[model samples]
Target: MTSSAPRRTVLAAALAAAAGAATPSAQAADAARTSEASAPAATPQAAARRSKSLVDYHSWTTTTDWHKGRAQGTGITHGARPGIHIVHPVGTLDYKDPHTGRTTTWDYAVWTSPAHSLKVPATEVIASWNAHTPPATWIAVELRGTYSDGGHTPWYVMGRWTAGDGASDIRRTSVDDQKDGRSSVSTDTFAIDAPAGGLRLTSYQLRLTLHRKPGTPLTPTVWRVGAMGSDLPDRFEVPASRPGQVGRELVVPRYSQEIHKGQYPEYDNGGEAWCSPTSSQMIIEYWGRKPTQQQLSWVNPDYADPQVCHAARHTFDYQYEGCGNWPFNAAYAATYRDLQGIVTRLTSLTDLEHLIHAGLPVITSQSFLKTELDGAGYGTAGHLMTVIGFTKNGDIVANDPASPDNAAVRRIYKRRQFENIWLRTKRYDAKGQVKSGSGGVCYLYFPAKPAPTQHRVLAELGIH
Candidate 1:
């Protein structure tokens, strides 16, 4: 389609004008406070019903979780943030970086998690992680899944990541062209080739390969690793949700992608394709974290919002050649100090309301025709935007990055329109061919230590 939306649309003349846009704890007394703050005012049964069944999220975060994995030259750390790390080199491999065509030898260690059965058989899965990759170190995340029919999938590379973009580090990217006849890896998602055929992913295992310079003590520390498996029903529309937080817009800074259209073409042709990182930057800063001046010094002095450019460069997926890789954007957000990010699916707008109500902004991915979302002006095969809050009438107030300038980035989209466009799994393209929707894929960034209320809400949403 000819449009300005990031990653998936072609540039159009209209884009030049369109560019716009938690807590607590305590012991016995703490228990009472936690219940009061976390439980909805309605009833405990209501809270139970709120737990969704369309999606299942599983992760390995604690030392116990690490021990459950079959480790080869890997060891678990003990502390407030337990993790798996390379204790000894198990082998060596020569990696040829496609982006730079540079070959380098690195020592590596492997940790394979035990198979995790999904609560719901899923048609799609997206993996995410939080890690500290010091200079010359990085980690690769791979997944192997079992189909409901008892067929097994080959180990698929979900991402090859590093927190840094320096010469010593390999370009963080998603493996492309990875597919079997039954399933495929598109960017960062593992999806069944034909869900309508009655095939589903019943279980899966994650494999982490930690890489570092040969003979060096450097090792990547992985704090968290997990995936979200979902099987959302195919629908052209979703049920509308009642507004809960009316007139509660959070003050989030804005940056327009259209304005930086040609700033850094090497990173997916600059801002025209930078919605993922741009949206990520907004939430990263919303939590009081941002790239330091030193980190942003590489950008041309003339470009505005160099931080956005910085974000784009860091979150760029060389293989996919775009910044819209979901897990990469979340990984980029976690690079900021004291922050954690994850890629997950929310079942409804009420899930968003819970986070926004707890003072969190969400970065959501969606695809729609021009007629599907009013005020968008242009249609997109895919796009990313920050859901800042709700309008008095329950509409969505978003920091849409596809605007003409920073001031024009704030937009209020219709509630039912926004929800359907975001939550639906199937939609008709401009040519009327069926295309996949994001199914409520979102990037959630929050502090490592959240307030009690924020913690409660996040836990309620199955994030903790």
Candidate 2:
């Protein structure tokens, strides 16, 4: 019950819970389906041990040492600026296995420079990256000799994650660089956002402390690979001496005009749901800086799941800090009952027979989907979305990430077609409607903070 390593012990107990947890898979078959069963709390320790059994356990490392990859091809060109570059390959590193060896593969991307850039003293700087999802954690990135680290550190931490299906979660910090003598190759996995179809828009960092080390001197790498499995053009046309270099978030729901739109320095979404990152990108542009391509995406593990309708109230609270507890839907709930977030989740959604009490807004999806299905009249299988908010008229207003036009729509349920589409999931409300407005559920996401409509983000890129 009491942990020797408070955080570690806490992590261990959480992990134990994850090992025994299970989540209902929604469209688990669909590549883009967001619906997922919330797994229990996972101890990265156990998952790491079990990963060997679940995955083919491929290692992409080439050296059993702490040797950096050679600078090849065209390193990111910063107009005239420069910086450092760090790469993490995919797959398992069997340091636990006696003869398994280590693996660290290079990003399929080539760079003409390092992973850092120099920002002029006291002057705001601009840092940008390209590619698909970057690493779950990064070791080090250099910018103009000044170093900014990511992942987890002794004091500051990025986050933690569970690797692979059924694999234990790892308590990893992005900035921690603890490489024991032995080494293994990294086997990088590519997400849809990579050099392929679809886009989840990852790779955070545009704000200060934005993380990284300055390479060489008086130089900034304009373009570099910021993604995990792929490459992106880290080009910057601005300079540090020029007077502008900070970005802000957006006030309205907007879309980037291109794959290379400029993004904000800090793309944090804690204020709101997935909108934080999106607004950050927009903020940077509206702040006077030319909008470059940036990455951003929203995740709803369950949208069309019949077993799990809306985001379980327990989940949002548990993950309000971070959804790292997922994979094992209900892990850590019992392990640490006193924790604030934990306590919140436990009481949010209690079942009272037919009515499933929701903590977050639970709108009628079955009804809405049915309406869309009937309106389209003849289409393929329909799906569900999130009910974010409501209009002044008490009309249910929500957002369905799948439907571009899913914003604040009222004319969905027109006929029996509306009723039929929702029937597919069987998650209908007590009255058999897609979204019933009876539960006292917190809307999924609300505007966190207001931005200055007239404010502009100005950035400066100093070459040292």
Candidate 3:
């Protein structure tokens, strides 16, 4: 009884990619949207839609050891960079960074699947890196499954195996296979056929839904990313995704206000409004249906932990007393990182609401925050820019649709510079909510099939 599959369409990059945003353009501000809407004009926008700009990117040579990319076997330990929930249904699984001292990332993604009755397939899990070498960089994507009966009965991964990169062709084997290491770039689209269970959309698919392109919001929970190899047929099963329930565009009027003035005199330059919350708000709105106290309870903008203060102290203070778990929560933000590895995920095209529901952090890193501050080329300016996505080269792109003179180039922090700014805060217990005096349990739910919710303080917003 699966709902009709949505129409398929080509997918946009999971992350936003706009560089050189220093000031806000009155005209630009008047035209900008939030979420992926915050990205700077795409390199091709001028040739297409003549879009405005919102974020940027610059690569670096930093490497973080992560568990092996493939989940089918033992985990690989790369230096810790940052990671977030693969997908989301609810409950916060936090993991703070030793560097940021905040939990903004999650090791695994949980779905509300019915144990012994329902089974959800992991769609697409990908990782990209700068290939010091060209043409022959072996791209490896691994899949590993960890089960915990201590928490839920059907929570166990009977047998987690990968079906990409290395496997018999789908014509020979019906299931998906591991992607080839030869095609390791982020832009590469690994192709495969859906097995009997088909595939479930990943948070990545949700990331691309904002645009509502023809083949989008692939309901199979399939990974709508790129392919990078020979067997790669350069194909995609895009679904006809509409703008979900998140209606109307936030910052529309605000952009109008800025554009009318011709420029944002606020930050030494730009004229754009910080469209950060648009996505997050949209998700909440969609989930609310009739609107309730649930949606308004807490807002995690990745600012609650000391890691943020330490990294981007000047941006969001530790004692600012704002959002529940946010970093730069000058006031009214949300923080959701604790446990093992914490990461702040910001996609230029990403909507906060989408990430939240998928269990990802909607905030930017302190290093990233500083880059915006520095990028603005402003002297003594305090602006709030949201983290979008980074490039293979290590550049941190962001959405600062508000900088006037330098708003367009407001923030494009170097990896090192951004990280330096994020290390000034004092540490707090990211794992514990309400001062986290003790530890709690984690659960996996499959849609309306409640997994386990005894200790978690459920928010009215459902799961975002």
- Largest TM-score belongs to which candidate? 1
What is the per-residue lDDT of model 1 for residues 1-464, given as tens digits with 9 covering 90 to 100?
11123332211111111222123112212333443465354347536754546888788987888999999999997787788899998999999999889999999999999999998899889999999899999999999999999999999999999988788989998887777888878778888776766789999999999999988888998888999998877777788788874666766778788888988888887788788888888887777677889888898999889999999888888887877888888887777776788999999888887677667778998888889889989888888999988888889999999988999999999999999999986677788766667789898887777766667777766677
The candidate with the higher TM-score, 1 or 3, is: 1
lDDT of 3 by residue, 1-464 (tens): 00000100101111110000011223212322233343332234332221121111111112221221222211222232232112322222343322234433212322221111112222222211211111111112222221122211111111111111111101001112222321111111221123113323221211111001122221111111111111111111112222221222222111111231212222112222222222122112122211233432232333221121121211111121111112112111111111111112221222332332232222332212222335544321112343434444445444443443223423455544443333221112223211100000011111111112201111111121
* Candidate 3 TM-score, true structure as reference: 0.22
Task: Give each model's whole-structure lDDT.
Answer: 0.81, 0.20, 0.21
Clash numbers, per candidate = 18, 125, 153
Off-target runs (Cα >4 Å) in candidate 1 are 1-43, 50-52
Q: Which digits, one per residue and each the tens of the lDDT, describe model 2 over residues 1-464?
A: 00011111222222223223311112111101111122112346434433322111111111211023344321322222133323322222322211123232222222222222221111111122211112231222222212122221111122221111111211221222222111111111111111122222122222111111122122122122221211221111111121111111112222211111121111111211222122222222222222112211122333221111111211221212221112111111211111100000010111100011111222232222233444332222212232322223222233332232223222332222332333221223334433211111111111111111100000000000
Per-prediction TM-score, please? 0.90, 0.22, 0.22
Query: By summed lDDT, which 10 consecutive residues of candidate 2 come out lowest?
Result: 455-464
Q: Could you list the CA RMSD of all candidates, in the order they appear?
A: 6.3, 23.0, 22.8
Given candidate 1, what's the lDDT at residue 410? 99
